[model samples]
Target chain A: MSATLVPVDEAPAPGASRTKPRLAAWIGYAGITAVLLLFAFGSPFFLTASNIATILTQASVFGIAGVGLAIVIIAGGDDVLNGGIDLSTGAVAGLAGTVTALAAAAGTPGMVAVLYGVLVATAIGVVNGLSVTLGLRPLLATLATMGVAASLELVFSQNLKIAVTGGFFEAARGSVLFGIPLVAWLMALIGAAVWWVYGKTSWGVNSYAVGQNPTAAQVAGLDPRRYRLASYVLSSALAGLAGTLLVARLSAAVPGIGTQILLDIILVAYMSMIFSRRRLVSVVGTVLAAVFVAALDNGLTLLGVASQWVGAAKGLLILLVLASVTLRGRKNR
Target chain B: MSTIETLAAPVEPSPGPVAAYSGKKRGTLQASRLVAPGTLALILIVFSVLSPVIFTVGNLFGILGQVALLALAAIGLTLVVRAGGIDLSIGVALDLGALASAWLIHDGYRAWVAVAGGLLCALAVGAVNALLIVILRIPAFLATLSVWFAGTSVQQLLTGGGAPIYLSAPLVPDGFAVIGRGYFLGIDAAIVNAVSISLVVALLLGITRYGRKLTMAGEQPSAARISGLRTNALIASAYLLCAVIAGFAGVVLAARSNGYVPGSGQAYLMDAIGAVFIGATISRYGRVSVGGTLIGVVIFGLLDNGLNLIGLSFFWQDLARGLVLLSILLAAVVLGRAKSRPATGIFALLRTTKHQALTNTAKGNRK
Candidate 1:
């Protein structure tokens, strides 16, 4: 899928212009850092090292999912026709995570269990990819995927939350290095990998082109469909990994877990796009925004606000950010 | 606007090989055959084979009664779809209506007041949705999504952890039950009531000036605007009108159940969307119609009842529904494309702006 760098205007995100994006990314990061520092002072327990670690870990789970979502979003062309949103993302993750737990509980090796989980998720992801390329409208295909994933979750879990009954999450939750949870670092690693791919590779640049203008990409002799397919497959695979991490965090495979977290994942992904070099959705932006969201959620919970209301707050926050960004764009124009 | 103009260019010849295959009348007939009744035929065959017990008129009416609320939601959504827009908030909109009525009824209001309050809530929901899409200029899907999120939150706040509103306390009038379970002559009141609402919508779509402009605005927004139609208002009104009907359905559901149940309307979302889209394929106009939606509703109603009668668990039922929805959608895409090669919003429901900044700024520049 890697295309030779052809230096197209639509393909500039991965190379020569890479240096220009750093400044904008930092500007966004600065806001998030300030909020973190504010919370550190405002909430008595905010600055605690454990709490900081917890927030990062929480953000990382959502961040991994966000990475997949951001990639998929960036892979879509304007003419993609309501094609980019994937409502089934969380469901896919939950299924993968539950399968991993179930596999581990049945005495499969932990590594193998994880492999099995990822593989199953990849298969579903491939199906999603194929559907888009095969001319099923992205919205309907993904909506159907969501339905199937949700139902599959119900069938597998039998409406019950399944505990791993083994050491599935022990390493995920217990292992830490350099003052950060292993999972958080894994999230950073994946984020960096995605950033590198989009910033340094031709295939990544080609995807950017396809997203910008599929006709131009097609005329350039590039297969936009493959890129689109790859995007869905990649997102599904990442969602699978997130599902496993989610199980690790919860120590159980909870049915319908995706329903709760999918929105947040999508929210963080959109936030990442908003906060980043608005022209492009970047990995750094997604991770930073996810962290910010995690901190905000943690801060509100600490203030004794009900989680239900917090859900509303998240939705409102996204709308506010989106509106401001849009309004600002209009003003500039 | 150019894109919209292209869409509004009165039914041009399709651009591909399929265009050369079918004659005009034959192709139109073939496309219409695949929509609503096709789904019904599919359901009737499979379900009848699976469970002959559910293939009866009694079961049919029972299924209709069960899906009355869903039919109402679909009818509302049909208007939105016909306008080249989609609403993801219909489920929450239903909740808003039910909660509004519940609040009024619990406060010792008469049944009529509660019903009025429910309709008012629907109207307000429609207004808010209009402001979001028309004034704020967000895409229809995202606007409704925002409404869904905010409404769900407000609903939670309103209900305080979503406690059910029991009508047992001062008792809802016995006459209220008629809306859900009453009989008119030999037919079930719920079915009749739902059908009557569909009839009114059909008349609006078929004969009224409002309907004409709405069809024009959706199928050809730029053309409609050129002809002095308030396209934005028409789109917003479609949403508002949909919400009001959904609200009415919620009230009836509240009456039937003897209380207002939180989040109960969520299940209707998929079925409503499924019905409308499927309805379009089977529709003679290949546009949204009350008749097409009614058939789709009956199809869905039967599918659910049959699936249940066959003793499939809820999860299995959901899986079946999902598969059925996907297949129907896949077929719709193929048949629709074969009939009209134009790639319009009707087919591209969610393919709007993920990058709101670009879409909005561009839209502003055009204006």
Candidate 2:
């Protein structure tokens, strides 16, 4: 996976030259900040430390899942055939939660239950990876996995919400350090680790190379398929982790839980691209975008807006970002 | 002016993998074209053995009725995919159509007017999709997905918190009921509508210049553009037609259910996509066709009917369907790869390079 294995001249450049003003890249951050300020001014409860903590806690699930999705998109690139996307992230999360909840109810140790849940999700991810590397389109491959995972979730949960209480659940739901939830902390740690791995490691560089142009990467001696497969695995594993945490936070494994927030996860991942300097998906940007989305949802709720409006607002926001990005790209060209 | 001449020039059959694959035998049947029908027959045989009730005329009609809406939706999906785009928001159009028409009928509007209203609403969605993808340059996948996300929320708002709008039996107009349940020539009206629509689409795509150009645009947009084909306009029309057809399906869905069910149309989204792709395996070069999509829909309908008849639980049915879809796709991919590979020769090298160039261009156009 090392870029150094290929001669420097043979490798494709990492990214296009940064010609756009730095201000353009900061639009996403500015938009999030403006929204936060609007909420603070509009609602007295919005600025409270507790509310901030709640937003972070709420954002953790999608933040963790978004990190994985961002990696897949970055490594999958923009090509229609090879571009990586995992439609099963939400289903994987739901299935993992179901597994953990069922195992815990069966008197399994909390750690082992979590392990079982993650392993099941990871195994499904392997299937997805194999499907894509074996030449099935990424969209179709993940879509098939999504269906299988959702059905499995129903089978395991018996179409009923399985409530789990005790050891791990109690800790996950109740634990807070310095007024911040444990899940939020875990999300941050995962994001930071991924950022380092994606930015500072040769594996990360090679993944970018592979995404940029697979044929070129092949010519340069990098195995693009391995990186693509690894990206899917990482995405699903993180989704599994998010699902386990979601179950602990909710104290129940609800059927179709992951599917409910799938749009938000995808939105966070895609929106993060607008924040990156090179318009690529990045860990830091995804985490930030997730928090912003969670905060928007929280603020809208506090303002007594209907949940439906919040969903519509998110869709509109993404469209606005996409339009501006496209227009900007055209102008630059 | 020059562009018009280029467009008027009769299209020369493209020399590519598709032509190469089909060239050797003009009159002979392609084995790939039988995959879907073969799978359908296998399912029919297996299900008939598993359940005594499967062969009953009543049950067979029931399966056809069940597949009608799905067939319409998948046909719509096929057109969009053939025009080089995906429409994830088709369910949105379907739901909106059902809701709008149901609301109108509930308010005592004439059946025809209500149907028109539903289709209009769906057409608006198509317009938004066109603006995003064709005008604003958003990728079709993301654009349609956004519409789906926003559109579902709109449906919820209209329904006042996701409740279904039920039309009581007494208020149900005869015209509306006829669309869904009445028989025409001993066949369900819904089934009749689906069949006719499928035939029309088949003719439109297979015989009309517009249809051929749309397929050409999808397969090779750059070449289409060079030939003076209005690819953007063709793509936009495809989306519009897809939405309208899906909207019609939704209207029938509403009439059949005697109300607008808020999320019922969403159920068809994945199934429709699965059907279209499964149908793709039936084409020599993996192009989608109306006949193939119909067969795919029938296969799904049979699985649902047969599995339920066998007393399999709902979850097991779902699992079975998912596995079936996965195995079919895997088989198709493996078969395709094997067929394309050549043992040795300069001709093989040339073929491989041509195939690579086609794929690369397809990828570039999609971006």
Provide per-model DockQ scores: 0.27, 0.26
Per DockQ, the best of the predicted structures is: 1
**lDDT (CA) for every model shown?**
0.73, 0.80
Runs in model 1 deviating more than 4 A are: A1-38, A78-81, B1-28, B31-36, B283-286, B335-365
Give the Cα error of residue B123 in candidate 2, in Å. 0.8
Model 2 TM-score, 2 decimals: 0.91
State the lDDT of candidate 1 residue by residue for A186-301, as single tens digits.
99999999988865677777776666545445556888788888999999999999999888888889998887787788778877756644334667778988888999999888
Cα shift from native, residue B22, model 1 (Å): 18
- Top of the candidates by TM-score: 2
- Give a tens-digit lDDT track for model 1, residues B1-367: 1121121121211122222222233333455345556677878888888887876878877887888888899999989888878888887778878888877877878878888998898788888888877888665776676677778887888888888888784466656666766789988877887889988999999899989899888755655676788898899899999999888888887777778888888779877877776676665445778877777777777877887898888887767777777777676666655665443323333222222212222232234
Chain B TM-score, structure 1: 0.84
Q: How well is candidate 2 docked (DockQ)?
A: 0.26
In CAPRI terms, where does candidate 2 land? acceptable
Clashing residue pairs in all predictions, respectively, total: 6, 0
**How many backbone collisions does model 1 have?**
6
Query: What's the TM-score of every candidate structure?
Result: 0.88, 0.91
